[model samples]
Target: MRVRNKPWADDLITENPQAIVLNPEHYRGQWQSRFKSVQPLHVEIGTGKGQFLIGMAVAHPEFNFVGIELQKSVLAAALKQSLPAELPNLQWVLADGQGVNDFFEPREVTQLYLNFSDPWPKTRHEKRRLTYKSFLKSYAEVLGDGGQLQFKTDNRHLFEYSIMSMTSFGLNLTELSLDLHADVAASQGELENIETEYEQKFAAKGQPIYRLVAQFPKK
Candidate 1:
C-alpha cells in the first residue's frame, strides 16, 4: 500500500477538521456526539486508502464509523476521498492502534475491524502484529463484553497466528472463512463482504482471503 507522497496532504487534512478528527481522545466516551445520530460505533484499524470504511459508512448509516490510520499521507488520502460524500456518520483518526483505549471508553465501541494489516511475519516481530495479545487487550477493553472483532487478511500465516492469539486470549470465534470470495461466489453475492483496495488487489491475483469474526469474552 505504497502511496506517492501527496504534497497537498497536509493542506487537505488541515482544511477538513470535521471529517479528520485531530483530537480524537477528546471525544472519548462521547463519539456519538460527532455523528448526526446516536448509534453503534464501529472502528477500523489500519484503514488504508478509505475504500472499505467509506463503503461501510455508506452501506450502514445506522452505525457510526471511525477509521484509525497512523500514516499521515494515507489518512489524508482517505480524508480527500471522503470529502465529496461528506458522510455524517464517518470520521478519521490519525493515530496508532495501540492507543485505542485512550481514544474510547470501555464498551464504547460496538465492533472493530482489521483489514489487510501488516503480517509482521518474523517471529521476533510478533508483538508488532495488530492481532498480538497486547493489542488484543486494548481491543477487548475498548469493546468490552460481547463486543465483536472482525479480521480479514490475505496472509495465511497471519490469519493462523491471529486465531491462536485471540483464542488464547479468551476471545470467542463466531465465524471464519479460509476463502471468503469463494463463499461469496457460492452464495451468489448474498453474503455481505466489503472489499478493501488491498483485498481487491490480492483477490485479483487468485489469493484466498481469510476472514474471522471474534467476540470478547462475556463478563
Candidate 2:
C-alpha cells in the first residue's frame, strides 16, 4: 500500500484529544486509570485503518482498547474511522510496536492482538516480526498475569514462525487453527470474526487464515 504524505493526518490526530492519547508515554502504567474503569486493557498492535480495533471495541464495551499504529499517514485513516464513533473505551496511540513497553507498565495490559501484521520474511529480519522472541519479551513486561496474545495471519511461514517463537519464549499455546474462517458456518461469535481490511481481502481470495492464542506465565 502506497501511503502518500498526508499532513492533515497528524493534525487530526492531535485534534482528537478525546479519542487519542496524544501523549501516550505520559500514561505509562496508568492506562486503566485513564479509562476510569477497572476493565481489562486490550491492545492491538499494527491496527491498520482501525477496523478490527473499532469493531472489537464496539462488540466488547466492557473491555478497554488501545490501538497502536506506527505510520502517521496510515494511522491517519484509523484516526478518522475512530474519532467519529466516540467510543469511551477505545483510544489510539501513534508509535512503533517495538516501543510498546515504554507506554505501559508491568501488568498494565491484559490482552494483545496482532492481526495480519507484516510478514518479515527474510531470516535476517526475524527480530522485526511482531511474534519474535525479542518483541514477545517486551510484551511480557506490559501484559498482566496470564495475559493472552491473539494472533491471526494469512502468511503460513509467519504463522509457523510465531508458533515456534511463542513456545521458545515459554508461553503456552492454548488454541491453534490453520483455517480460521472455515468454521464460519458454526460460529458462536468467535468464528464470526471481526476481520481487518487485509483479512477480508485475503479471505476473499480463498487464502487460509492461521490463528493462535498464547498466554504469558502466571504471576
Candidate 3:
C-alpha cells in the first residue's frame, strides 16, 4: 500500500520547503528553530499520507508538530494536504524511524506518536517492531523529561507483545485499551482521540483498535 517510485514526488516535496524539510539530516538539533514559537515538540514517526499528524496539528495549535515519513511518494501526499492548511506550527521531515537519535539532540522531543505502526509479526523480525527494547532505547535518548509515547494498532498479538516489552524494559504504561471503540469503561472518558487512516479503515470493518501510552521514569 505504498508508492515507492513516483517521479513527481520528490519535486513536490522540494518545492514546498516552507512546509517540508527536504534535508532533514542537516536540521538534526535545529528542529525547534523552524517553528513559530518554542513550544513543546510532538513528533509522529511513519506518518503515512499524514491524516493523524494533520489532524493533531490542527486540533492542538499550542504544541509544535513534526511528521516524519520514510517514503518520498507517501510524504508527498501528506504535504499536499498539510500545505493548504497553512499551519505555522506544523512541519514535515523525511526520515527513517531507525535513526531517530541521529535526527534529534538528546531529550529534544517532548512527545512521540506511533499510529498503526508495522507489527513486524515474526519472531526473527521482532527488532523491527517500533516498541522493541532497542527502539525504546532510541526513543529514550531523544524524548525529553515527562515525555511519553502514544501508540495505536489493530494487531492483537503485537499489542500484547508491546505490553510485555514495555514491562520488561522498565517503561511504565500509563494507559491502555484493548478495544478502543467497544470497551466503554476501559477507554475511560473520551480521550482526545484523532483517527489515523488505518484506524478508520479497520474500525469501519468492526476491528477494535488497541492503544497504549508508555514512558520511562527518570531515576
Candidate 4:
C-alpha cells in the first residue's frame, strides 16, 4: 500500500548516524544512552502511519517508545507527526522488524505491541506472520524477562494462531478480549486509547477487536 497523502514524510528519516543503530551489536551496554535513563522501552513493530505509537508515547510520557516501520514513506509520515510534538520519550527507526534482535540487547524492551499486523492469509506466507514461532523467538530474546507482548487484530484465524503460538513459546497469557469496546466497560479504568490506523477503521465498522497480553517467562 503506497502512501498517497503523505505530507510529513521527510521528517521520519534521521540523518544522524548516532541516532540510528542498524546493527544490534553496537547497542550493547550503550543502549541506555539512546533514551535518557532507559525508563522502560516499548517497541511497536510495523508502526503503520504512526497514529498508535504517537498516541502511546503521548499517553505514557514516562516510558520511551520506539516505532519500527520498514516503509520509509509511511515512516516519514509518522516521524512528521512525532517530531512536531518534540516528544522526548518517542523515537523511531526505518528498518525491518525481523532484524529487531540485532539492534536491541537481551531484555532491552519492556513491552512489544503488534497491532493489526499483516495477516498474510496465504498458507505459503505463514512464515511472514509476526506471531509465527520465528518472530516470537526474536521477541523473546529482545524483551526483558517477564515483559509483555500486547497484540490486537481483526483477523480471527490470525488471533487464534497467535494465541497458540504464544502458548507454545511458553509465554503466560493474562488478558484476552474478543471484543475490545464491549469489554472496556468491564475493564474498569485500564482502557488504552486507540493507536493504529486499522484499529480506528475496524472500530468504525463495528468489528470486534481481538486482544491478548502474553508475558515471557523469567529466564
The candidate scoring highest on TM-score is 1
Using lDDT as the yardstick, the better of models 1 and 3 is: 1
Kindly list the per-residue Cα lDDT of model 2 for residues 1-219, writing each as its tens digit: 677888788788777777777678999978876675679899999998899999999999999999998888888898898777778888888888778999999888999999998898999988789998889988899995699999999999999999999999899998898888886545766565788899899999999988898999885
**Higher lDDT: candidate 1 or 2?**
1
Each candidate structure's TM-score, on Cα atoms with residue i matched to residue i, is: 0.97, 0.94, 0.93, 0.89
lDDT tens string, model 4, 52-136? 9889878888998888888867777767667667677777777888888887888888999999999999989999999999999
Error of 3 at 76 (Å): 0.3
- Can you write out model 1's per-residue Cα lDDT over 50-132, one digit (the tens) per residue? 99999999999999999999899998988889989989999999998778999999999999999999999999999999999
Which of the two, 2 or 4, has more lDDT? 2
Instruction: Show the colliding residue pairs in model 2.
Output: none
**How does model 3 fare in lDDT?**
0.87
Instruction: Judge candidate 2 against the unseen true structure and give its global Cα lDDT, from 0 to 1.
Output: 0.87
Tell me model 4's lDDT, rounded to 2 decimals: 0.82
Residue 19 error, candidate 3, Å? 1.1
Maximum-lDDT candidate: 1
Q: Which ten residues in a row have the lowest lDDT in candidate 3?
A: 183-192
In model 1, where is the ten-residue run with the lowest total lDDT? Answer: 1-10
TM-score of 1: 0.97
